[model samples]
Target: MDRIANIHTLTKRLIVMTAISLLVFSVIFGISYFFNGRLMMTWLGFVCGIIGGFVSIQQRIKNVSDEELTLLTNSWFQILLVPIFGGVFSLVLYCIFLAGIISGNMFPNFYIPKPSGSVPDANFMIELFTKTYPLTGQDFAKFLFWSFVAGFSERFVPQIVNNVADKSSEKVNPSDR
Candidate 1:
């Protein structure tokens, strides 16, 4: 009877996790479609979301209760937030690289062309934000790679860091020390 109850509980958790994963992937796909209007971005977001969801569940599966699973699945919003923040961070870095404000081997060669006559302003920035660039296969691959990194690391990296910090801060016995 106990084994049966455990199986039932495990099944429920699996179903909930699957639903949350799909929800996360759909939201990502919708946002990417709205912004870029490219199938590649949609696919990239879907793959990233799945990878992120799997990583999250795998990390928590061993000790998670049904209630905790619900909470964790609901927190999948971080999957979206991380990638958006990462995209903004990448944009800022690209801008800084282009402006000659920071020059070194650290920055890649961003291929954005200089404006012919007018200086960039708020309007230009707005246009840049709304406009979808023509991405090559290599560029799309790089974008997807970064998206995966952002999504996968959103929760995983922080958890690992916290675990390491917590372990290090634990006091050792006088004899052990």
Candidate 2:
């Protein structure tokens, strides 16, 4: 069994996340402000980070409850987070795609559908994507960036939350055991 998976091993994960988030947030915000003279990007990142924390908790619930691990390790719940994570990442990437294209002052070749569904008359979803996000150089770059960020955030969030949960739990010292 992975020691890190143990609830007692959470401190290190939290520490690492806190340090990395702080550093990354500061550097990105600084660069953005220097160029745009505004705190929008920084604020966005902070908000995303905080939201990411909650998302991480959700993932942790899934991780801790994984059948293979749960049977061997005592936990509080059971869930499959892969679909949830996929949905979240997809949305994140979509938003990033939109934001990046807009920022680059370029219209995407693809057309996203509105909630009404009447706005887009396409019969297929893939066709919709084809119409919405242009597979251009800038679009591809933005897509990659979004994928990387979303994936990193998703994968790490659970680890952070698990660590937090573990740290909060009462520890059983070896002498006591």
- Model 2: colliding residue pairs: 10-163, 110-131, 110-132, 110-133, 111-131, 111-132
- Report every candidate's CA lDDT: 0.49, 0.45
Q: Model 1, which residues run further than 4 Å from truth?
A: 1-55, 58-60, 63-118, 132-135, 155-177
Evaluated with lDDT, which candidate comes out highest? 1
Backbone clash pairs for candidate 1 read none
Model 1 / residue 165 / CA error / Å: 20
- Model 1: per-residue Cα lDDT over 47-157, one tens digit each: 564455445445555576655545444454532353454344444333443454444443233344344347887766544544433245555555455445444555543
Superposition error at 16 for model 2 (Å): 2.0
> What TM-score does each of the candidates earn?
0.40, 0.32
Superposition-based RMSD of candidate 1 using all C-alpha atoms, in angstroms: 10.3
The Cα error of candidate 2 at residue 121, in Å, is: 28
Q: Tell me how far the alpha carbon of residue 61 in candidate 1 is from the true structure, in angstroms, after superposition.
A: 2.2
Q: Estimate the TM-score for candidate 1.
A: 0.40
